[model samples]
Target: MATGESRARSIGQQATGRTVLKTHPGSKTAVLVALAALVTGCGGSASDTAPTKPSAGHRAGSGSGSDGSSAGTVGFDTVFKTEERFQQALPDPASMAGWTPRNASALIEDDPEPAARCAPSRDWECAKIAHGEANFEAFGEEADFDITAFVDKAGAGEACRKEATWSAKYTKAPGAAVSDVESHAYYRNVGGENGLYVTMCLGTVVAEVTLAGPNSSLDPDTAHSLARQFVPRIQKAAAAS
Candidate 1:
């Protein structure tokens, strides 16, 4: 849970609209209007989108790796799977200890509060933590890596598009050469179960991890690491969830 002061600070930052992605002019109006309608129809105020209930039977997949290492399960809600090679490619955590969350909550809060927009999953509990938004999805499923930890660096084209508006910033992991730094982007599947969307970062050394669920908050790097540590444990929990 976040302290009152922390939450207040977060709210203040949000109110100032500092990190809101600058959308293209032609589409910006439409997007904002559509988002407004979504909030209104969901019985959520313009500012609050947290849901009141939990989703049921969120099926996840669980499996073991060829080497007998635990390959985590994927739930029905799971959108994409990370390849083993990709997980192995991540840089050592020791090299990234200094790569702490940099205003990570800003990244997570890019979207509206989910608690009002969608229900929490039965396997998980939704809460707003200090680091960011978090969804305590009970892992009944298992996988080799936490699918969420992987960050997506925007592609060249996307990066170029973004560059037209704002300068792109790249942070290289300690000891990682400039060439090793890569860009990725957030991906979400649309058209299913209210269409799940995820906003996260991907780096050469960092793996992708789920930042938030439908009605949860995102956690910072430390929290993300803690969650990653439980990748194997959560595989079981997700299977059970």
Candidate 2:
């Protein structure tokens, strides 16, 4: 459960349009990345479009609840088999090349309130059983990296699409990717900093890669490539589960 102050901050963020990330004993880049998904955190409206017909990489079922809101779920266990598996799924320093990981290890969250407040809407705040994230800082560059994966309940393709569409609407981003998988890329300014937020869904797993920094050399294309690179990794991990 969240403390009163934490809950208050959550409400404040939604009500006042002011984003505040509670201090974590993690790296600075992690804190900054939390702001990247603030506006579209967990809760989504009923108006966004939901994909009909089961898409590849998503389980078949109805798109959303008859109420036209995000469909609820009973949730899942670790999306990855374990915390170690979740960490192993993230891109390493060698894979990232120019970026050096800042956090001592991936930050894993099983708590609902904070992640529900910090992640993108389709990332499914409350439905996630485990959320793992890591931060990296570019060598001799202003860029930073924040990537996350979620263990969410399966069968919410339409709800997830609805949430993603809602977030894209606010970011003025293009629609979801037209591929065998369900994915999206959004480039925009959040909390006054420029960022590219790319996300994908494979079964019960949701993955997001965000590149953000003030005066950062990173661009939308870089984030897009990273998301693409992560796809197979996430698929393998989800398969193991």
Candidate 3:
């Protein structure tokens, strides 16, 4: 959980209209406004207009994430499989880690919408990310990635639009790609959940792992460290078929 002092400092900063990330905030401010009126993390993402969807990057053709991709296909079951994969992808509170890693309370499917929005009257208005179509294949139904991780798809030219479209300052985590059509992996605080969210985007395929404590934990530093440690492993597992 966030230390009382730390929470006070964060509240002070936000009250002044200043953000936790100032220099490298993405293109827009992202706030994960949920069913409650909560202002979460803020970061930058891609532009407003939807970019052209790229080819399916995950192992859709092979029918499993561990089985390297062959034919052009995309789906969650193949990308996210074992519960261990999901567990290892985030911090483990059961092991005395800062937060408990579990399947997201809700899963977001891939959509080609330009932006994430909410009705002002819904008490849930925030700068959420929205994305467009992809050039990949779906795992028809037997897929299990959906069983493990929450997925979100977005297109921003030749980049991991889903990762780029977040409201946090993203430092390059280890093993993240360095290319035009590359994946951008990162993590940041999610205030509403009182934790941090780790996002790994391999083009159209995105895995969202939240590390939050039941006790209102807000450990951004731990979140980043955990993300740096786990994202690479997840990527490797995704590649190892």
Mind sharing the TM-score for model 2?
0.53
* Deviation (Å) of 172 in candidate 2: 4.2
Residue 16's lDDT within candidate 1 is 30
* Top-scoring candidate (lDDT): 2
Return the clash pairs for model 2, or none: none
C-alpha lDDT values of all predictions = 0.24, 0.43, 0.28
The best candidate in terms of TM-score: 2
Native-vs-model 1 lDDT? Answer: 0.24
Assess candidate 1 and give its TM-score to the true structure: 0.19
RMSD of 3: 19.0
Model 2 over residues 108-157: C-alpha lDDT tens digits?
Answer: 44343444453444444443334455455543232322333344444234
Worst 10 residues of 2 by lDDT: 3-12
lDDT for model 3 comes to 0.28
Model 1 clashing-pair count: 55
Tens-place lDDT digits, model 1, residues 1-241: 1111211112112233443333443222111111111112223243333222222321221111122224443222221122222223222222122221111111121222233332323211122211212122222211112223211222212322332223123221212111111323232333431111212222211223333335322223323333334333323322332
TM-score of each: 0.19, 0.53, 0.30
Descending-lDDT candidate ranking: 2, 3, 1
| lDDT (tens digit, per residue) of candidate 3 on 1-241 | 1011110111111224543422213223222211100111132111221222223541212211221213222322334423333333322222211111111211122221223332222221122222111111121211012112322333212123323544335443344332222334343444543433445444233544343434424234433333343344445444545
